[model samples]
Target: MIQAMYKRTKIGCEVLIQQAIDECPISTIKLYISRYYKKNNQRWALWARQHSPLLLQVTSTNSLESYHSELKRTTSSHYGLIGACHKVVALDQKQRTDSEYVAFEFRTKKISVMGLDDEILNEFHKFPYPIQRMLADEICAVENRIEKGKAIPGLTSLHCNCLFFIRYLLPCHHIFHEQIYGPTKLLTTNSWRNFQLMFEESGFEVYFHNELIEVDILEQTKAEKAAEN
Candidate 1:
């Protein structure tokens, strides 16, 4: 008889298993889901269950410091250190005060503000909530319209190229005009770009203004033709 010697050792490897539920116990919480299937020759009733994790697997190493640091990188180039600092201060002020408007302007040269007064009054009927709600809704609506290839109506200017401040801090227009502007020019493109670059370098994303182009329902232009093709 031959003698055998064995040594224990730890081993690990990632494995993907088929019909994964077989490896684990199902919870008693029975959920009903609707599924549709095509009809085939044989008449049969089938029951199948599947489990999908709702929350993604999160590794909790990243922190706020890392995030802010990333943002600082993008913004520093566009806005100098001082201008960037001012924007941060202005943003904080806006958040605290809760009165701010974004830079928006009419895309069409001939566009008239005929219904603007009524819209403004109707939307901001309440003392505090209306204005807030209007801003929130308008932002969402404009984003949606842009995504859906629809026209975004009405535009408001952001004093100067202070789009960075508006995008980041969401300050009220009154404070921006009174506090931020200087010597006729409120903010310049270079200043805004630098500030925006700093934010970008610091790991923040910039959302530029929406493109102003009307889609003709009746006429199919060359650009539209190429897209369809």
Candidate 2:
């Protein structure tokens, strides 16, 4: 079962079953295919799932350490579910306050522009400071990366197949290359259509002053104000 789970195609599963179990391999593989996979391609199969070989690059144990430690310190083992819920709400409020402070600082003290393309950098600056910082670092990585064989997922939109893009869902080196070298157009709110959006519609306000991104705040604010009410 363990080895069969790795098989992506029906044929692949049958071959594995044949190698392992000499009898009724065909029937066994047919049953396995029917039960194990949804569409036979979207399982824990090695090729289907996007993952990086570097463990630390994708996820880190230390990333949640601060939140875990704070939660642990605030909540006792003896607390009931309701008490624990209250502790979590308090902790969340504290973290949100800290985040708002950092965001305010980022807005007032604009981050240093690291990338060369003024067009993209202009868009990058509008996002929250944390997102701006993240994108700036990505641009630097792209600038230094040897682009001989960048794993471009597609050029239809700003998307890449690289581990970096897969992990962050941000513009990767390949997408940057498209804008810099290829015939790809400039960035805009509708840049990613039929794909994952980088930010919410409310976050689009950050692009207000950017000449390249033609976002209409006049129309947006009406709905935003209504939603808040």
Candidate 3:
């Protein structure tokens, strides 16, 4: 339970730990939980797992360390400033290109597993590029959701307590099972555009330019008040 809690969100971790702590028959285990796990629990959040250009699917610094080592292996101290800069940029470019290639392959490939029919794949394919990209992660996790059984009004109700939805504010695999109800809007809206798709895909410096249009968004959404008319 303790080991599994590492992948769970902050609230999920707390709930699991509290249950185990209360039900534990061994005083030593309970003490261990309270003293160690509870004390430094903040560090265990899914914080580091959120994907970014620099970190690319990393759960920790291992990949970053490995990347740095690769950089050292590829370039030499004798290369001096100019040569080293060229090698470093080349390596960075290759890495980003490889990432893009893999993403493209996945997007084009027809997913065949987890009981997904060709028709369903077709439905997913009909969404625009950005919306499809937003759904990619959710689609990959559909099997896992099937294994766990689809969530029922999870956490606060509309969305699951999983890290993906919390981080992106789009439909997680759980709620996405009902995509027929329409979730593409969330992926395209200015409020979520900055996050729904992977950010900093082409560069390292990150910034959001979406906050300036809240008034426009409100006006665009005023149609929701149709009944008031």
TM-score of 2: 0.43
lDDT of 3: 0.57
How many residue pairs clash per model?
Answer: 27, 0, 0
lDDT of each: 0.32, 0.59, 0.57
lDDT tens digits by residue: candidate 3, 112-197: 33555555455555443444555666766766666786643333334555655654445677665544333332322343334424
- lDDT tens readout by residue for model 2, 1-229: 4565455455675566445444445776766655654355444443343333222132346757999898998899999999999999999999999978876665554467743666666666655566677777776766555454554323876556565665455676667656565666534556633122334443433233222234699878987999999
Please say which candidate is ahead in TM-score: 1 or 3: 3
Candidate 2 clashing pairs, residues 3+ apart or interchain: none
Q: What is the lDDT of residue 212 in candidate 1?
A: 29
Candidate 2: where is the Cα deviation over 4 Å? 1-64, 67-97, 103-109, 147-156, 186-229
Q: Rank order by TM-score, top first?
A: 2, 3, 1
- For residues 1-229, write the lDDT of model 1, one tens digit per residue: 0000010111100111112223435433111101111121011111110011111111133654654564565356679779888866765575445423321111111222233344333323311332244334443343455577654222234432222223333323332333232233333444334433432332222222212255777576776888999
